[model samples]
Target: MVNPRSSSSYRLRRSRFVVPPTIYRLALILLAFSVFLFLVSQRQIPVFDRGPSLPQKSSELEERLWDSASGYGYRPCVKPTHKYAGIQKSTGATDHMFSPIENPKSERSSATAKYFLCAFVLMSYTLYCRFSPIFNFLLASSHYICDMVAVARLMNATLIIPQLDKRSFWQDTSTFSDIFDESHFIKALENDVHIVSELPKEMESAPRVRKHFTSWSSASYYEGMSQMWKDYEVIHVPKSDSRLANNDLPVDIQRLRCRAMYYALRFSNPIESLGKKLVERLKSHGPYIALHLRYEKDMLAFTGCTYGLTDIEAGELKILRENTNHWKMKGINSTEQRLGGFCPLTPKEVGVFLHSMGYPSSTWIYIAAGDIYGGETYLSDLRSQFPNLVSKVHTESLATVEELKEFAKHATQTAAIDYIVSIESDVFIPSYTGNMARAVEGHRRFLGHRKTINPDRKGLVKLFDMLEKGELKEDTKFSSLVIDMHKHRQGAPRKRYGSLPGSKGRDRFRTEESFYENPFPECICPTDHH
Candidate 1:
């Protein structure tokens, strides 16, 4: 009913409210430019634009690891053809050097190189008891020692032999030599960092700096520590915790870690001989699956897993967890831990998983563990499926098991034997990916992509809940679900997955990356294949 001229005028005024085409285009362009600047500031755009290139190399080992055509991956099936039963008989220097120590010539050359480096830094593990309930020799000496060596090198400080913790639960006064090849360890790092036995007389009074307990520290954290060289004459790392940065280390420093752990840190001759013997015995049953059953009292107590335990056992583990001072997060609910799959797989669950995977009932499983919490009663379910379960504790020949008991007095020695057998086994499976499991998995990857079946814990727990509730049968449905769930986790040749989404700042390195635990895709390749 309005006048046409008035309506037309109103329409023209309304049209002016709409943004013009040129302004809209300009706004979008400004937004895009802001995003581009943000990406450039983050250093994300360049990383993507230039397709994945190998990290830079500084050592012979790094050179081998980064070789364009061959360093990245290998055929998993092609194992070393040579059959060597004993320590000496094992594949010699030409192959993947499994021998605890390199020869005297290599040691001497490394030592000579060490004599020309900077001032001395003496490191000692004096935090708690040396062999504390939480500390294992492999972790305390082998793993952290490598990190310390790398730290010493980065600081340009000559490393004195780190004093091993002697006063712990074991009570044995085991020195560095008692556990590791001390001479070889010192010599091995000669090229990378100078190592001395005792403090020089005049430099004994030099000021010492004890590092703070900053867990999974950053490279910047270490660089700041390196800056301390101007003020202090010597930097002494008094404790082992928070000793090394997670990533961003130089290629030589990382390679030095490899050298320190795999080659230099040799087990004592007797331990090596026994470990080799154990490997041979496990192999006597043909190919065996080494199961790292992390159901021991200490492990369960620490993790707060009580799925298969009796009321009494559960109460005890709960008390232990509460009492442990260093173990954070004490008020964990056992049911929640199990349902969320944060708990280690119970023996029964492990049995179900393996049976569902189509492993025959007669398959030999070597249980690498210290004394389990509930002992035979808890293991009965797994034993019912895999009756050929052998450990240092239980084996076919009771006499052989008895002989092993003598060496088993030293927990580290027994652990070494278990490690050697696990690494050389046909397959390795761990109920929980604890330190031992992580170390073994990494070593297996280094050997070649040896078959390691890591359980999809979170997914399996959901399926298990359905089965318990009678929603899903224990037949083909369960097997198919489990098999499909773990397809990607079967030790396949894949590049390392980066930090989890939303992980920022120090939190990015907070939870130790699996690749750092197992440096396969980075450090491992087939023999001469590269």
Candidate 2:
């Protein structure tokens, strides 16, 4: 090549030609015509030969959807019918509540402009001639939006929204917030299920939904609960407005029963199979202590042992000797197996520990341990080392699964909590989870069921002390439970509490020590604390 640089220069020089001005002008005209045509044919507001009335039955863009979804033959798009079915039973509460005027002024204004602009564009393009592709698309979209909005307005929906504050919802309360988060208003809509919005009052916090009413399909159930609350407000709206009274809608009696069940089953999911097992094996009796020792990964990944080790690990062999002292031989089958003394205990060991703690361990000691059967041998060995005092202990494995379903659920945090309160006569002395503690408090509040629970006071005291040090209220809500724990032991046993071994936490983690007594050591009682 003559010279690479020179050759490149020649190519650049040759490429510098410009189009003629006449040709440029023609191109601009063509572009403008295409844009103008597109805008005209898209979503144009029809220049109806008639006055500004609702667009008539056919030719008008709006009529296409009405025609399609109005009568029996309108099943193809599934949208308009969905909308119509939703608003069918409404008493106009939803329509007024969520009326366009209720939206923020800015949003309403913008939507109005957008609708007008789209209509203008359609009119501009279609006024001239056939713009088949554009016109068809615009018609389909209009049908979809209009049909959906119409359903929400008419309250003819097969479904009902109990929680969401459609523009018509009149009140605001904490209870309403709970209803909104806990309710299934959005999910029903997404699934194309039609529900009317009729519970317009703010006080109507709890919601109930009706599903697939048009098809006479099975009725939809409220997601969480259906209990008759002791303190609940029952609102019996008119049949026309209440999904509960919708005779045409299918009813789910099983769903009705589910809501009224004794315990909240949310805790029973990932732990369902296990929950069933516990349900089957559970023996209700006096109070029991639930000890959950988070182990394993805490040993390795926990930068430097987050929760800390018991004397079993800190002092090693020496603490193992200490653990040996408290090992109550369990007569009942315990899934007990120790990990290391200070480390996490095995599920069986946990069972054994509860057994050794007081009377019967088979009573519900809901634990959320990562490894239920993981460290069985170590725990059993410790139990074996001291067979006398511990031999009467009984522990039934409360949580065990081949594969974890819900990490938190399997943790048994909630169940461990309510386990104590549900046994109103009993108490739980758990070594972990104030969330479970708060949950117990909440469950008691909801159930209007209260129990005297004295959890591991030694440790709880330290925590509360820390809270106080940090300037936090000792008992955010359940502070009443905490008193001078040493004060009253009227019916409590003085002996058993003293002889019982302290927590496995040795020098690794310091805990206040107070040996509590067991009134009914052979059995279990709320008054007992070992």
Candidate 3:
């Protein structure tokens, strides 16, 4: 009952659609057969495929760039880049990528194989798309070529990263990752500090900052660390097991990781921005002493420090008994009191003793320390005792470690020893650090020219011993307590010799005049006094 015209139109539409599809199928099969016949006919295309292309030379500008960063030497602080390219498979650094130097030789073959396998998987998926422009861009951005190039560049030397520099190392993201992952970034840092047992004469002669970054084979150390991964047959410290899903690093490695965390997190303050406030705290045309106090947990746990006592107590603990079976309480004539208030001091008791020394009130004091509350009460007593020299010791006076680190940025930091020695002070003294082999060299460099006494050895032996027993705790805070208490009760002076004020800058808190050593009848205060 359908109209003949409508039925005819439907049949024509179906025929047109069916005929085009069939024709397309037939054409596709014919095209494939023809391509096979063509391949068989022409086995090879004749082009200039005789030899590899000539290698490209690096530009003078590129050479200059590398040279300038390397301090104008053939030996750059950076390692050769080629060693890790096989694993990285990129011409540049990659995201969270690590050098596979954890294993060497055949041991690392499995890892090397895995890298290629990943590349193969990716390549197979994109076989048809490999020649597309979009595909090339993605590959470039993916870091495979860049990483491979970086590894190839590293072939000249085992090293792969840059040296320690505040400005250069942090400027660009690419350079940063390349330099950062070359080795255990923090591997140079050590608890034993025994790496440079026999320092060269050049190092011994260096002063201040120059010594800190001194060239200790400056050639070898960098190269050794760079090649460590490639040469090591297996891991040196330990490896992460499957137990930890998130973190596989062992304890020692975890500790090493903390340094990087600290470096990254550390704040750098501007010289004028924050220094203005700190300088404002100081008085003009007067003797001001800086008392650095550290009460952090790390400072409090040191055994080499003391429990607080007078110099007399330090000199003669058993003899003070006066031969009486019960020789008891004779108020300590503190070492600080012994100084007659000539020098500046630290911690609660040292501050108190300084206050007592300036009883009539002579010098203004700046108390710098952490965990200010730890010494708040003692500082209060000091303020009450000497109100003059003890004018400004308080929680507010303590600069945070953050502040010090910030200051270090503005401050062309030298060795602590050098700074102490450079001061034309009546005395120069440091409590917990400085004057170690590394610091001594710097101190000699900066302060040696000035002839300041760099007494960084104040607690070296004790600090090391404590560090060995895994007891490097409460260092500065404990030392402060002991030193302060000794000054208050024993009348022990800080140091007989120290530099004068205004040697470095008016706002600067270090000087020889502020130095002190307990001057009991005995040469040094006894090592073990609870």
Q: Which candidate number maximizes lDDT? A: 1
- What is the per-residue lDDT of model 2 for residues 233-351, given as tens digits with 9 covering 90 to 100? 23222111111211222112211111211221222232234434444443342233333334333221211222223544534423333344333331211111111122233333333
lDDT of each: 0.63, 0.29, 0.29
Ranking by TM-score: 1, 3, 2
Instruction: Please provide TM-scores, in order, for all candidate models, with all chains considered together.
Output: 0.72, 0.27, 0.27
* Per-residue lDDT of candidate 3, residues 1-530 (tens digit): 99999999999999887767889999999999999998865555321121111122334322311121221111101111233322233343221122343335674666754653453333210000011111111111112212212222222111122212234211222222222222233243222011111223333332211111111111223223333333221111111111111122222222222222212111122322344344444535243444343322222221112234344434443343233332243343434232333112234444333322221234455433333333544456556544543212133453345655533322122112112222322222223332121122222222221111222222333443464487754333434433343332211222223345556642232332111121111111222421
Candidate 1 wrong stretches, greater than 4 Å: 1-137, 170-172, 197-204, 218-224, 396-402, 405-408, 512-516, 525-530
Q: Which parts of model 2 are misplaced by more than 4 Å?
A: 1-277, 284-366, 372-374, 377-425, 448-530
Q: Per-residue error at 108 for model 3, in Å?
A: 30
Which of the predicted structures, 1 or 3, would earn the higher lDDT when compared with the native? 1
